[model samples]
Target chain A: MESGNLSAGEERFRKFSVYRIVEHLALIACFTVLAMTGLPQKFYSLGISQLIITSLGGIDSVRSIHHVAAAIFTVLALQHIITAFIGVVFLQWEPSMLIAVKDIHDALHNVKYCLGMAGRPAMSGRYNYKEKFVYWFILLGGVQMIATGFILWFPVIAANYLPGQFIPVSKVIHTNDAMLIFLLTAIWHIYDSIFNPEVFPLDKSIFTGMKKTTRT
Target chain B: METVINNKSGRMGVAAYIVCTALLVCFALPGQPSFAASEQGPRKVDKLFGAEGNADEDERNQCLKCHGEKGSIKKFPDGDFISTYVDPQAFTSSVHRSLRCTACHKEFSLQHHPERSFRNKLQYRIKESHVCRDCHKEGTIKSVAVHESLFRKERAGEAVVCTNCHSAHAVTPAVGGNASTGEEKYCLRCHSRETKMDFNDKECISLRVNIAELRNSPHKNMGCSDCHFGFSQENHPQRRFRYEREYRISSAEMCRKCHFDKYSKVSESIHYNMLSTGRLDAPTCIDCHGGHAVSSLGDNRALAVMKCRKCHGEVYDTYAKSVHGKALLNANNKDVPICIDCHSSHSIKNPSSSAFHDYIPEMCGKCHSNPTLMGKYGLSTDVVKTYLSDFHGMTLGLQRKEASKGYRPDPPMAVCTDCHGTHEIAGVLGADVQVLKDKLLKRCQKCHSNATSNFPDAWLSHYKPSLRVAPLVFIAEQFYKIIMPLMVVGLLFQVLLQIWRYLANR
Candidate 1:
C-alpha cells in the first residue's frame, strides 16, 4: 500500500494577497457605518436627536434600514458557520480545531520549542488550537449580539418575562460587546491572519472560501 | 484526444463556467440591490405673463380654459401631478400674479396630474429658505427679526426651524383645527416620540406637567409665550430655559397684572417708594419667596416663615432656635408667636402699634397663663396676672397713647424687648443679665438716667407673695424672728433679779 501521490506542498498551499485584505476592510467600513447610525439613535437624549431622527425621515425608517444591514451581517455569519461545519464534518480535516487534551499539551510544547529549549514541537495539520478558539469566540459573540440586540429593541416584550433592570443591562452588554468585537477583529484577527510574519501581508481563505489542497 | 475535444464537451464546459460566475456574483452581492432614480430637471417658464386680475390675450386664451374662466377659482383635480385648486381672488391679490404658478411650483409642469404622494422633485429639492436668500438678496423674512430678538434677549439658539414657524405659501395662523392647535400642539408634536417633530433624533418627550398649580403665584397669569418665545410645537432646539436676571421681567409689571390694588399700595409704600430714588435695598417679591420655588403664602407655613426669615435672617434664625420656635414646631399653634406676630405680615405698621405693644404682654400671657402648659413646670401664672396689675402694664392698658411713649426709644419702659433681650431671652436665674439683676440698672438707666439701688424694684413687676423677697416686709420678718425673742428673755431676767433681792431682805 502507498499514499496517493501529492502535489508539491508549497505550490498547493498558496499565500494570500493584499486585495483580499482590502476587501475585508471595505466590509468592516460598511459594518462600522451601520453601527454608528444605529447606536447613537438608540441612546437619544435631546432635541437635536429629534432633528437627527427627522433627518433619517423617521424612527421607523431608521429601524427598517438598520435591520436590513443587520440581515447582511447575519448572512455573512451563517456562511462562515456553514463553511466551518463542512470543513469539520465532510472533509474530516483540521483535527486541531477540536479541543482535546493533546492540543493543550502540543500548545505548551510549541511555546517551549519557540524558546529554543526543545529541538522541535509536535506539528499538526491545519487550524491551530488558538485560531479555533478565536473562531468559537466569534460565533459566541455573534449569537450574544443578536440575542441582547433583540431584547433591547423590544424591551416591553422582554419585560414580560425578564426583570425591568435587565433591559438597561442588556443595552450595556450589547453596546460594549459591539465595541469589543470591533476591537478584537481589528487588533487580533487582522494582525494574525493578514499582517503576521507567517502569513506575510495577507490571507485569502476568509473571502475565497477554499483551501488550496496539496494532494493532486 | 479528438473525442475529448468534441462540441458537446466544449458546450458543457462553457455552461459550467457561466454558472460558476453567476454564483460568485450572488455571493458578492449579499443582500438588497439598490439603484439611484433619475435626476429631476429644472422647471418650464412662460414667455408672456400678465397681472392676475388683468389678463392679457396670452393669459385669457392660453391659461383660462382649463384654469376656469377669468375671475373664477381654478379647481384642478388632475394633470401630470396632483390637481391643486388656486383661488382666483388670492392669485389676483398676490404679489406674484404677473408670474404663472409654474414659475414657483416648478414640478407641476405637465398637463396630466401626478399621484397624491408624488414628491415635487424640483422645488422641494431646492435648499431650504436660505436657498431663497440666494436670489432674493434684498428681502428678509420676519422670522429673522424674531430670531435676532430671541438671541439677544435669551441668548438662546434657534429652537424651531424657519419653516416650522413660518410658511412660504401663505400666511398661516399660529393655530388651526386641521394642523396644530396652538403653542401646546406645536410643542407636543416633536416632544412626543409618536409625532415626526424631532427631526434631529433629540429625545424630546411630552411630559404631562401641570401649569394650573402655578396660578395665583407671583409668576401667574403672565403669558407663557412671553417667556417661552421662539419655542414651537415642532422639533424645538434644546435650550436651557432659565429665569435669569437678563430675562427677568419687572416684578411690578408682573404683579400689576392681577394685583393692581396691591401694586398700587406697594408702589406708594416704602419698598417701591424708596426704590425710585435709587435705593437698591428695597426688596422685591423675589427677594422673599425667591422666584423659582414661590409657594402659597397662605397655606405654606415654611414659605411664610422663610419669607420673614429672608429679610430678618439673623433675628429669625435666633428666634426659631429659641423656645418659641420649638413650641410652634411641637404644638402647631399660631399663638406661639412667629415673626409675623410681633411684626405683622401685610399690615406690619411701625414697631409702636398700640395693638402690637398692648398685645406683647398678652401674647406672652397666652403661654404663661395656660395652666396646663405652665403649671406642669410649677411656673407662676402671676407673670401675666401681676404684669397686668403692675403700674407699667396698667399704664400700657389705660393710656395706650402715653404708654406708646414709654416703649418709644428706651429699653427701660418695660416693652417685650426690655426684659426679653429683644431676640435672645433666658430665665431670671439664667445668664441673661437683662432677665436677671446685673443688667437691670443698665436697662433702667435708659429712661431713668440716675437709677440706683433706690430705684423701683425690677423683680417686683411679676412678684408674688411667696418666700421670695419684698425689701420692707422681709426686714420686718427678720426682726420678729431674732429681736423680739431676745426682748422677751431680757424682761424675764429682770423680774427674776428683783424677786431675788426681796428674798434676801426677808
Candidate 2:
C-alpha cells in the first residue's frame, strides 16, 4: 500500500507480508538446526559428522537439539497453515499459491521463451511458476516431515492403532524426505534466487518484503 | 777264519736269548701274586668292622660276604649297636644290584677303613653323602636351589644325604626300576619317617606325603621322577629345601614340560605379569591346584571364583555384592557367569586393555541376548538389539565389526561397562526411573561435556520404537516413507518434462 503513492521515477511493489517474512525466517532457523543435528545421526561415521556431534556435546545433545528444533518447526508450520486458512476463509483473500490451469500454460510459454520460440516472456502475477512450485513443495514437505517426525517421536502411542510396520516405514520416509528437501533447496531454490543471471547475487525481495517494478 | 766267526756269532745270540727270557720273567712276576690271590676263596678278616687284610674275591662280593648274613650286630665304644648284616636277597632284588658296595663308601677299604665318629647317625650319613658329589657333580646338583642351600658349609651336617634314602648295599637305578613304586618307597623312606628327616635336629621336617591322596590324584599314573627332574633312588632327596616357596617356584617348572600350551598362554596372563613384578603371593600352577594331588577342573564354576578369592579377597567381596553374584548365590543360577566367564581362565588380560574393552559388549551380549536366559529373570532380551540401533551403539558396533577385519577402530566408544560399570553392576530393574535417568545423565556427561539435564531423554533406554511408545516419531516416520518416494518420482517427471520441452523447441 505504501508503494501506491510512489512517484513515476521510483516504483516498487510489495511482495511478502511481514508475517510471511517472520515465518520464513523461523523456517530457515529451524531447518538449519534440524539439518545440522539430524544429518550427523544418519551419516554418523563421517569425520565431519563426528566432529559436529562432538562439538554439539555428543549424540545425546545432538538428539535433544534436533527434537527442540523439530518442535519449533512443527509449531511454525501449524501457524502458517492457520494463517493461510484464516486469510482464505475469513478475510476473503485469494489463495494465489493454489495451482491453476493458467500456471501450466505460463510454464509452457516460459519454456518457449527460454528456447527462443516465443517473441515475449509469459506474463506472471504475484507469484511466478517457479515460485509457486517451490512454495507448494515446501508446504507439502513440511507437512510430511511433521507427521512422520511426530510418529517417530511418539512411536509407542502411534503403534496402538497403526501396524508395527508403520514405525520403520515412517523412519524411511523421514530420512528420504529430508534428503529430497535438501536436494531441492540446493539445486532449485538456491539456483533461482542466488545463482541465476537474472538475480545473480541474491533475490532481496523476500527479505525486504518489496520488489522493484517498471511503470509503463 | 770263517769257522771261527760263525762260532762267535752263535755264542752272542745265546746270550741275547737268556737276557730277553729274564726280562719276561720280571714283568710276569708282579701280576702273578694278585692272580694267585684271587684263585683262593674269600680272604679271612682279622677284625670285624675294622681295618683288615685284603680280600682275594671280587671287592663287591667280598664286602657282601661279611655283611650278607642277617642280624649280624657290632657294639661300639659308646654302647650304640650297629647292624652290620645286609639282606643278600633284598640286595639282589634291589635296583642297584649290579653296583658295588664301595661305590658309595669310597673311604672304606680292606686294609684301612676310616674310624666312624659322629654324634648321631644323621651326622655320619651327611659326612658320607659327600661321596655322591664326586660322581653326581656339584654343578649338576646345584641346578636346584635346595641342593645349593643344603650343601652350603654352614649347613653341612644338617644336609640330606644319599645313604639316608638309598640302602648302602641295595641302591636302585633311578629310571626303569618300577619307578612309581620305587620313587614312592625310596622318597618315603626318609619322608614318612618322623625322626630320620629332622634337619640339623632343629626343625623336624615332616616330608610326609599322603600316599592315598597322591594315588587318587589325576597324576596317579605319573611317576614322581616324571615331575621331579634329577630325582633318583641314588639321589632320593635331591635337594634339602630350606623354604617352601623355593620348592614351589622350582617345581612349577615341571608343569611346563607337560602343559606347554597352557603354560605359554598363562605366561602372558595378568597373573604371570604380576609374578614378574615380584609379587611373591601371586599365583603359580601349584597355588591353584596342589602339585602332587592335582585334580581335574570339573564343571563346578564356583571353584574358580573361590580360587581367585584366595588372593583377590577385596575384589571378590565387591563382586559378591554385585547383582550377578547375588543372583548366583540367591537363585543358585548356573547360567550366571563367574570370574572366569568374563576374564577367562589362563589367558586373563588386564581390564584396561583395548582388546578387553572391545570385547566387553559381546561378552555381556552373550547371555544378555539369549531370550530364554533373560526371560527366566524377567529381563528384556532386546537390550542389545535396541542398543545396536542407537547412535552410540551403532558407532561401537561399527568399530567392533571393523576391528575384526584388522582395523584398529577409534577408541573411547561408549561400551556396556562405560554405563553399567565393570564390577559393581547393580540391579537397575525396579529402580526409580528418575534416579536412573539422573544416573544416565551423569554417565553421559562424562563424554558429553556440555550436556544439559534434558540430554538424557534422547536415549530411548533400550525401548524399541512402537506407535504406543513413541507415537510422534512413529507417525512422522510413516508420513515421510510414503511422501518421499511420491515427491521424488513426481519431481523426476517434472524434471524430465522440462528437459523434453527444451529439447523439442531446439
Candidate 3:
C-alpha cells in the first residue's frame, strides 16, 4: 500500500488491492439486479414488468430465481458475519471498529466542530459514526429481507404455523424491506463508497482490509 | 483453528451446493404426459351398392350378365352381344310390367344406353312416384270442384287428398268408405274439406302457432300435445277460442295448467303481485321458465345465476365466487336461495315493498339463521348474522322500511344479498380470502364515498338477539354457547387458583 499523510497539505493517497474492490462491486451488482427484477412485479404495470418476468421464464420462474439468489446472498451474508466475528475475536485487527460510547461523543464533537465550538477533529477510526450507522442498517435490512423472504418462499409451510393473515403481511414486509434495502444501498453505500470525496471513486476494504487514506 | 474452520466450511459448502443442484435438477424435469394414444386410420364404410374404384361398370355389367343369359350365345349383326330376361314371375309381381320393358328402358341395345343414363332414368321414376295428372284432367277438375263446393261452402267435412283417397297403381276404395279416425295416413288424408276440426279456426290457428313457436323457442323439449289435451280424431269436437283480451292473456296459463307444482309456488310469490294486479313490468313464468324451449332448471339450457346477475348487476358481480355461487354451480342445489327464493319468483312486486323490507332479515333468517338447515346443506348460517351486524346491514336497519321502499336510503346499506349473494347465499367461513377481501371493501364502499384501508371497521351486526337464526348467527350462537362459557370459566378458574394460593399464604 502507498503511504499517505495522517493530516496532509500533501496530495498523497493510499493504494488498495483489486480483489477488495471487486468483492464490494459484486455484492452491489447482485443486490441491485435482484431488486430491479423483484420490486416492479408488485408495484408497477404488468405490461413492461412481464419482460423481466419472462427473463426468468415466468412468474413462477422469477420467484424461483429470486429464492435461489436470496439463498446465495444469505450464505454470503453468513460468511461475512462469521468472517467479521473471526476477524474481531481472533485477529483483533481493528478493535476500534467496535461500537462504543465514543461514537456518541464523536457525533456530538463533530456537530460542535461544524458549529465552530470545537477546536479540532475527533480522532476518527476506520469506521466513523456514519459508516457504523450504515453498517448496522445493512445487517438489520439483510436479516429482515432473508426472514420475510423465507416466509414468502414457502407460504404453505409458513401458513401452517402462522395465521392466514401473515401471508399478505409477509408480502408487504418483504416488498417494503427490499425497497428500503435497495434505497439504503443506493443512497448510503454508493454515496460513501464511490461518491463521497473521502473515498472518491471506490472503497476496497471489503476484500483487502487495507486502509486507504485520501489526502485531506 | 483457521485451517480446521476452512476445511470444515469448504466441505459443507460443497455438500450444500450438490444438494441444491439436485433439487434444481428435480424442479427442472418436465411434466408427465397426460394423453392416451388414439387408434389410427380412417374408418371403412360397409354397405352394398357401394362404389369402389371403377366399380360402377362392374356392378352394372354383373347385373346385365345375369339378366341377359339368353343373349350370351348368339352375336348380333352389329357384333355386340344383346341380353334380355323374360321371367315368368315378372308380370304377376311388377306394378308396371303391363307395359313392355322397351318402353321404360328406351334405346334397348347390346351396349349401354345414351341420351339419359339408365340409373338416372330409374332414379327419376322413383322420385316422381307416378304421373296420374298426365291422364286424368276431367277427373282432377271434378275432384277440385267437389273440394271447392264442400270446403268453400262449409257444408262438407272430410279428410281426403288425391294421394290419400286414391292409389294410382290400384285405384281402389281407401277403407272403401268414410275414413276411420285413427288411420294415420299423410296430413292430406284428413286435412281436406271432408275433415271436421276439433277446434274453431282461430283456436286451431292459435294452438298451432303457439305449439310451432314453442317448438322453435328454448322450450323445444316439450311434446306438442303436452299442452293440448283430449286431442284425437274420434273425439274431435269444435270448441270456441279461449282469448282474454283484457289480460292480453299470457302463455303462462298453458304452462301452469300442467306444471302446477312450480307454477303455484311462483304464483304466490312476490313476483305475481306485480303482474296479476297490472304491474306489467314484472316477468312471469315464460320469462325465466322459457316459453318455447321450456326446460327443467337441471337442463344445460336453463337459466343460471349469471342470468339473474344481468338485472342485479352490482350484487351478482360481487358474488361471482361467493360460497353461494360455487354451491349453485357445483351442487346445483336449488334449496339454497336462488333469485326467486330471496326475491320471490311470482309475487316479486318490488324489492322495496315495505311489507317485505323488514322481512329480509327473517327471510334470510329462514335458511341462514337455521343451524340445522345450514348443516343439511353444509353451509354457514353466519352470513345473515354477520351481514345484519355488518356496516351495510346496520345502515339498512337504521333506514328501516324506508330503504326497502325507495332509493337506497344509505349509500352503502349492507343487505344480506350484497355480501353473501342474492341467488347464492354461501357464507364466508369457507370462502377464499380474495372474495372476502373484495366483499369487505365493496360492502363498505356502498355507503362510504371511497372506502380505503382506514375506513371505519367492517361493522358486522353479529350475534344480535333480535334476528332469527341465520346460519351465521347460529354459528355465533354456538360459539357463545361453547367458546364464551369456556373462556369465562377458564379465566374464573385461573383467578380462583390465584386467590386460593394467596389466601393460604396469608
Candidate 4:
C-alpha cells in the first residue's frame, strides 16, 4: 500500500491513504477469525481445540462463522485487486509493490551490512523487500485459500468442471498454506511492524498514514 | 467400557425399565432347586465347637461332631450321594440355627443313632419331608403362594421336599437379611436342579443353573435376589404369564439395578423402542447378557458380536467375514471393532437412520484420524481431511452449516459407509487398488447412475496423493510444501536483517 518514492516525504509525511488503512484492518479481522476457527478443525484432536469448537456452539457454527469471515475476506481481496487495477490503468499509477533487481541488490546489501560485510545498508524505494515479501505472500496465499475454500464450499459443482483430485488437493493446500500464512504473519510481519528495534512498539504508518522520515 | 455409559437415557427408557421390572415382580413364580452340594459350604468337621456363638450353636456343634466327620462326608444310598458332612458354620448361620437336631430328626436319640434307609434320594427326601408337617401344619403351608401348586403336586405324588428349595443345614434367613451371605445358596438349592417351570404349557423355562457357571459369572459376588429380586424361601408368589416373552422382558429388567448405565443405553436403543411398542421379538438385557451366568463383554469382545448373533445370525455371519470381524475373531485384535464397537451393546439405535448415516465418517474417523493409530496400520490419516474436502463430505458439511443458519440442503450425500459399506468395509490391508477402484465406481453409480468408469478416479480414496497415485494432486501439494517454507525463510531472513540494521544503527 506504500506507493510514494523513498525521497518523496518531508517530516512525518503521509504514506498510506485512509482506504488502504481500512483494507489492512479488515484483512487483519478476517485473518484473525479465520485462524481461530480453522486451526482447531485442523487440530481437531487437541482438547483446547475441542473446547473452542464446543464453546462456539459446535463445528457447524464454527464453520459458518469461518465462511462468513472468508466471504468478507474474499471480497476485500477482490477490492484490493480491482482498486490496484483501476489505479494503474485509469490513473496511471506506479506498481510500487512489484519486486525488482533493486530489491535483490538491496536484500543482499542489507544482509551483508547486518553481517558487517558492507559499509552501508541498502536504500529501499516505496516498499522495502520485507514489506513486498509480506504483501505478495499473503495476497497469493489468499488467492489459493479462496480457490480451495470455494471448491470445498461448492464441491459438487466443482466436480463438474474440476477433476476429483482437485478436491483433496485443495484441502491439502488450504490446510498447509494456512499454517504458512500464520507463521509468516506471526514471526516476520509482527517482527517488522512491532518487534523490530526501529519500530519497537509498532510501525503506525499503515494506520496513521504517515511516516517519520530519518534521512541520512 | 462400551456398554456402561451414564444413565442419561430419556424418561421413556426409565419407564420401560420400570414397567418391565414391575411385570417381573408380578410374574414371580418359584423355580425348582437341586441342593445336594450348594447349601453345604466347606465342612468344618473338627471345628464344630463355637462355644461363644448364638443360642443353638452348642447343640448343633455336638450334632455336627458326629455327622460332620471328614471321610464319611456323604450318605451313599444306592447311586445317590447326599452330603451328610454338615457344615457347623452353615448350621450356626441358618434361619433355624437355634433349633436342636432332634426338632427335625424326630424319633432319633443319643442312645439310638438309628440312621433310616430309603429306596432313593428323592424318596428319602420326601419321607424326611414329613417332619416339616410336624412343625408347619398343612393349612399354614397351603397358604404360601408356591404351596398352592406344590401341595397339589404332593397330593398327586409329585411334590419336592421342603429341603429341595431351602437346603437343610444352610437355610439363610428367608425374609429380609444380609445379601452378601449365602442368599444365592438359598435359590441355587433348588435352581441347581435340572427341572423346568412352565409359565404355560409351551413356555417351560429351565429352572436349572450350573452353580460353577453362576460362580464364574461377573455377578458372583451378587445374590440371586439381586436380580430375581423379592424371591426367597419367604414366599414363592404364584406367577402368571401368557408366554415366555413376559418372562424374558421382565428378566431383562434385572440389569438396570447394578448396570443402570448399560440399561439406560439399552432403553434408548432400537431394541427397547421395539419392545416398548409391543414388538416382543426385540432383544432386551437378558437376551444379550444372558440370565444368571451373565458375561463380561470387555474380556471377550467377540462374545459381544455373538450376543447379537442370537437374533442377527445372518448379519453376524456376514460381519464375521468382514475385515473388522475377521481381525477381531481370528487375531483377537482388541483394536478392531466387533458388533458393539459400532452398533453398541445396550443403546443401539437403527443404523439406517439419516442421523446415523451422516455420522459414518466421524465414527470411522475415531480410529482413521489418529495419526499414531493410522500409522500403526500404515494407513494415511489424511482420510478424514480428504473426505471432508471431497464433494460428499463437503455437501454434508454444508448441510450442517445450513442447518445452523436455520435451513438444510439435505441432499442425498454419501458418507464413509456410502462409498465403503458399513460392516462390510473393504479391507485396506493389502487390498488391490484396481479392485477398490472398481468397487468405488460401483458405489458411485448407486447415486450417480450416469457416472462412467473414470468417475472413481476423481475420488483420491483417502490417500494423500503421491507420485504413484494422483500425481497431479501430488505435484500441486509438493509445490506448496516447497513454496511455503521458502517464503517463510525469505520473510524471516528479511526480519533478521532489519533487526540487525536497527540495533547496529542504534
Candidate 5:
C-alpha cells in the first residue's frame, strides 16, 4: 500500500499518502460547506437560495457556518503548502506540481496531439499539463479568496489599515473569485476527474491514495 | 203593430237618458253639494282657516287677546304647568310673524281647547316642537341613540326640548342669522354651567366648556354644528358612550369627516394603530389639539414636546438628559431638534420598519448636513457627505430607494442611529477620545464577532479619506478600484478566447 514501484508486472502505484488523502477529504468537506453557504448570499433573491438559507437556520447561522468552513479551508490550504515545502526542503523530493518551462512545452505538445498534428500524446511526469493548470489556478484563486474573505469577515479590523473603500472592493473580489472557482471546479475539474472517458466514474486515487496503472 | 210599439219604447228610452244627463250636470255644477260634502258636512274646519266672512288675522287676534298677557299659565290636573303667554313683540319680530298660531296648533279654538295630557312642561314642549317637522323637514332630525336612550331612562322633567335652546316666540331662521354666534350661545346655555350635568339619573358628566377659550380659538368662527353636524338642541347628547374611550373614538370619527385626508394618514400612524388595538391612552385630535380651545400649533416647540411627553415619559426623560435637550433648555436654542423633528408630527410609522429604519440616516442628514443650520453650532456639514460615500451609508441609501419601491431590503446596514443613540443622541465631539473609541468598539461588537479594540479604528467617524486620516485605506481603495475592472475584463477575455478555441478545434 505504501509502494510507488513501476516494475513491469506492477499493477498499482501509491499516488498519495494517507495524510494527504485525509487533507483532501477535509478540503472537499470545507469547500462544499463554504459554497453551499456563500453562493446563496450572492444570489440571495433566488427561491432556492432563500430555501437553502432557511434550511441552514437563517442568514446569521449560514454566515457563522460559512465562516467556520472558511477557517477550516484556510487551515487545510496552509497545511498543503507547508507539506509541499517540507517534502522539497528536508526530504529532498522534487515538487512535481510546480509549473516549469517543461510544463509549457508539454502543454503545447498536448494541444498538437489534440489537433491531430502529433501521432502520440506528450509524456508527463507525476502530474499532467491539464492537472498542473487546474492545480495552479486553484492555488492562486485560493490565495486571492483568502485575502478578500478575511478582509470581509473582519471589516472593522481591515478598515483600520485599509481604506473604507477596500471593504466594498474586497466584497467584489471575494464574490467574483468564488464564482470563478465554482465554475472551474464544476466544469474543468469535475470533467477531468469524473466525466472524462478515461476516468468514467471517478479518479479515486485522491480518496484511496492509490491508482492502478498499465505498462506502455 | 210591433214596429209602432218598438219606436215608442225607443223614444221613451232617449228621454230618460236626456233626463239622467241633465241631473248629472246639475250635480257637477260649482254651486252644487257633492256626496262627500253631504256626508261629513265640511269636516270641522282646521283652526288655521276661518269661516266665509272671517279673516285668519281676526281668529289669531282672538287667541292673542288671552295669550298676550304675561304670566298667563295653564295648570294641569297633574300639577305640571305650562306657560300659555305669547310675547307680542317677540312674535312680531320673529320670522314666523305672518303665520297664525293655529298654523302649528291646528286644534286651537275659543270653544274647545284640547286637554293637555303631558306629564311635564318639557314633555309638552317636546311634543309641541313636532310642528316644526312639517315645514323644517330637512331630513336632519333623526333621533340619535344617546338622546333616545336618555329619553327612555330619564324623568320627563329632566328631558331636553327644542324650546330650551330656541325660544318659541323669538324663533329665527337657522340659516340667515349669525349662525355661529347663535349656535355657540345655544350650546353655552347648558354647557357653560360650572356643575356636573345629570343624564338619565344614573350618570353625570361635566357640561362645562370654557366659553372664553373657545371664542379665542382658531375655530372661533366655526359653528358647533360644523363638527357636530347632526346634533340639535332636541337631539342633545347624540350618542351614549360606555366609556371615555368610546367617546374619543367617535369624536375622532367626527374629526375625520372634515380632515379626512389628514385623518386617513394619521390612521396609519403608530398612535392610531395603537388606539385601534385598544390602547386607550393613544393620542387623538383633541389630545394634542384642545377640543374647543384648539389654536395654532405654531413654533411652540416646548408645548409640542410636552404633549408627546404625556405618553412617552421615559423617552422624554432620556431626551431631556441628552445633549440636544440640554442645549434647548440651557440656551433656548431653536436649532436643536425635538421629538416631532425626527419622528414627525403625524403619519409616523413604526421605528423598526425597514422603511423608517432606512430613512433614519436621511433624517439625521436633514439638520446635520444643513450648512446654514449646523454652521451656527460649529458643526461640520460634511458628516452626511462623508457617510454617503462610506460602505454602510451607501448600502443604506440603496436599501432605502429599494424600500420606497416596496421591496424588503436585505438585512439592515449600519445607519446613523446604529452607532449614535436614537432619542438619547449625544455630542461625540466633546467626549473624551478614548471613551468614544471604547464606545464605538462596543457598538461594532454588536454585529461583528470577536471584535478587538483596534476594530473601531477602522471607522472614519463620518469623514472621507485624507492624507492625515486614512492614507493606507485610501491607497488600497484606489488600487482595487482600478484593479477590479481590469481583472474582470482579463478573466472574461480569457474565458471567451478559450471557448472560441474549443469551438474552432471542434
Candidate 6:
C-alpha cells in the first residue's frame, strides 16, 4: 500500500489519498467563496466590503453565487461524514478525527512539556487533537449554515409552520458563524497545518499525499 | 556717372517715384474714392431710384442674376456675413415687386459697383433702411406704433434696423387685424437671434425664443399674439417686470386665460397657498410644465415624478431605493405607482394635514387593493382586510364616515406609512431591512411612548393567525367561529320563542 515509503529526499508516509485531497480542495473552494460573499453583506456599509460585493456582481448575483457555494459545501460535508463512516465500518479505516481520552492526556502532557515539567511531549497518531477540533468545528458549523440558509431562502414558507422569529435569529447566527468559521480557517487551522514548527513551511500532505514520518 | 545714377537717382529719383506711386495708389483705391467722383456717383444713384427714376423693372431683373446666386455674399472681418443673395421668388412676390434694384440700393450698379466698408451687418442694414423714408412720409411712418418705437430707439443710439424686423426682399403686406399673429414673422426676425432685455431691477433676461421649440409645442397651431396679448405689429405694450421671478410669475398668469380649469385647481393647491403667502420659491405653472421646453408627460406617471425631484431631491433618492421606485425607475414598469399617481398634479394636498393623513391608506389602497398587482409580487391581498380589522383602520373607517356627514373627527391615527414607511416602502418582505426590531420599536413608540422592545410584538406581524404563529389568537378565532354563532341562535329560540308561547297559553 506504499504506507512506509522512503522518498528521494526525506522519509515519507502515505497519508491523504487522492480522493481525500480532492475533498479538501472542494471544501476549500466552496468555503472561500462562502466567506467572501457572506461577510460583505454583514459589513455592507464599508467601502472595501461594498467593493467586494460590486466586484462579485451586485447583491442579487452575489446572493445567488453564495447559495450555490453553500449548496456545494453542504453536499461535501454530508459525503465526508458518510464516507468516513463507511470506511471505518468496512475498510478498517481508523476514525482518527474523533476525540479520545489519549488526546486529552496528550494535550495536558504537551502543556507540561512546554513548561518543562515532563521529559517529552505525548505522542500522537495520524490525526492530532488540534486537527480533530478543526474538523468537528467546521462540520457542525457547515450544518448550522445549511439549515439556516434554507430557512432564510424560503422565509415565508418556514414561518408558516415554525416561529417567524427563527428567520431573523437564523440570519443573525448565519452572519456571525461565517465570521467565526473564517477566523478558525485563517488562523488556527492554518497555523497547526502549515505554520506550526512541527511542520514548518507547509504540511504538504493534503497536496502531495505524503506526510513526514515521525517518532512515536 | 554710375555712382550719380545709382546713388542720387536711387535716392532723389526714388523719392520722386515713391511720391507719384502713392498718388496713383490713393486715386485707385475704391473704399476711399475721389470726393468729386463720390458726389457724381450718388447723383447718378439718386436719378435711378424710385418710381420717377429712369431705371425700370428690366434693370432690376438684370441685376438679379448676381444677387440671385447664394455665393454673392460680402463678409466683414469683425462680424456676420451679409448675404447679397436675395431670394428672387420673395422679391418678385413682394409688395415692392415692381420697384427697381436702384429703388432701395442707391449705391450699386453692375458696372459702377464700389467696395464699401462697414463695421457689421447691422450698420449696413441701418444705412439701407434710411431709404424707406424717401417713399413713406414721416406721418405715415409715425402712424405705426412699432415704427415710432423703432425710431425712438434709433435716436437713442440703439441698432434698431427696419430690415432686421421687416425684411427688405420679403416685405409682405401686413394683416388687417389690429394685432394679428400674422406679425409672427416680424417678431421672429429679431427674437430668433440671441436677443436680451433689461428689467427694472437690473436683471437682463434672454429675450431669444427658439422657433423650432415653438413649432413643436402644442401651441404650434395658435398664434404668438393669442397668448402674448397686447403685443404685435400695431400695439406692443411697454410691459415692465421687477425681477426675473416676477417676470416668470407674470408670464405664467397668461396660461390661466386659456387653461382656466387647471389654473383654478392649482389655486386650491398647497403650492398656490405658498405662492400667495410670499414664498417665492413655490413652483408656478411654467416651473413644472416648463416654458419653452414643455412636453406632455402622458400616462407614464413616473416620468412626471421627475418634475417634483427639483425641490424634493432627497425624497426622490429615498424613493428610488424602494421596491416601487426600483420597478418604475430601473425597469420602466409603468404599472408601479409614482409621485403624482397618489398626489394630484394641480390640486396637491398638504401631506401633513390631518385629512391627508387619513387619506393615505385609501391612496395606497388604490394599487395595493388590486389582487393582480399584489399577487404578481407574491404579496397577500388579505393585507387590506387584515388592516381594516386592526384598531387604527377600524377607527379611521368610522371617522371617515363621520367626516362625510360633516362631523369633526378625532386625533391622528396610524396609517400605512406609520408602520411600513413612505417613500422607502420595500414591499412586505422589507428587503432592505436591517435591525427591523429597532425600527419597529421606534414606530411603536410613536403611539406607546413607554413601549419596550417586546411591546411591538403585541401587534404580532402576521397576515393571518396560523397555529404556529399566534396560537392563542387562532384558538380564540376558532372558538368564535364555532361557539359564538351557536349561542346567538340558541338564545333567539330559547328566550324569544318560549316567551311568545307562554303569552299565547295565558
lDDT leader: 4
Which candidate order results from sorting by lDDT in descending order? Answer: 4, 5, 6, 2, 3, 1
Share of real interface contacts recovered by each model?
A: 0.00, 0.07, 0.00, 0.42, 0.13, 0.00
The sequence of per-residue lDDT tens digits that candidate 6 reaches over residues A50-147 is 67876775555677899999889889988987988899999998787789999889877765655556766577888776677678878887888888
What is candidate 3's CAPRI-style docking category based on DockQ?
incorrect
Q: After superposition, how far is residue B410 of candidate 1 from its true place, in Å?
A: 6.3
Instruction: Let me know the DockQ for model 1.
Output: 0.00
Clashing pairs in 5: A162-B473, A163-B473
lDDT preference between candidates 1 and 3, better one? 3
Flag the better candidate by DockQ, 3 or 5.
5
Once fitted onto the true fold, the runs of candidate 6 whose alpha carbons sit more than 4 angstroms away are A1-216, B1-93, B97-122, B130-157, B175-198, B204-220, B229-236, B291-294, B398-411, B430-434, B480-506
Docking class of 4: incorrect
* Second chain alone, TM-score for each candidate: 0.45, 0.61, 0.39, 0.64, 0.60, 0.73
Listed in order, each prediction's TM-score against the native is 0.35, 0.55, 0.37, 0.59, 0.56, 0.54
lDDT of 1 by residue, B1-506 (tens): 12422457544543333222111111111111211111110000011121333344354334446554434432223333323334344343222334554455444444634433323422232323443333222222222333334334324443333333332322122222122334433433222323221122343333332344445456565444444544333223343322322123343245455556756666654556545665556566556654434556664454477677766789777766666675555666554557666554444544544455556777677678888787765677878877665435543443443343343322323655665655555445346634455466566556655555424353354665334545443443454456444544543343343234334334
The residue ranges of model 1 lying beyond 4 angstroms of the native Cα positions read A1-216, B1-173, B177-249, B256-277, B290-293, B297-300, B328-335, B350-385, B395-412, B427-435, B439-442, B445-456, B465-506
lDDT of 4 by residue, B1-506 (tens): 11211234533332332222212121111221221112222122111222223555565667778787755544545777675677665565554454577767867655567867777777777877778666445554565566567776678777667765555666543322332225564455456676566676456778788888778899888767777776754546677676788878877887788888887887788988998899989987778777877777667888877888899988888888888888888999888877777776677879976656667788888988989877878778888998987556765754554444454333457888888787786586688878877888788878767566556766777766789988977887788879888977877777777667777777
* lDDT tens per residue, model 6, B1-506: 23433464344543332222111111111111111122222232233332433447568767877887878888876868887887766655443555677757878765667789988877788788888656554444554444565566668778766565555775533332111224565566556666566577877888788888888788777777788887755455556677787788888888998999999999999999998998878889999988765678777667688899989899999999998899998889887888887778898889887767788888888887889987888777776666766546754654554454454443367888888888998765754434676787798677656556544544556357668865655655565456545644543333343334334434
Residue B37 error, candidate 3, Å: 69
Off by over 4 Å in 4: A1-9, A214-216, B1-141, B144-235, B251-280, B285-307, B313-418, B426-435, B438-459, B476-486
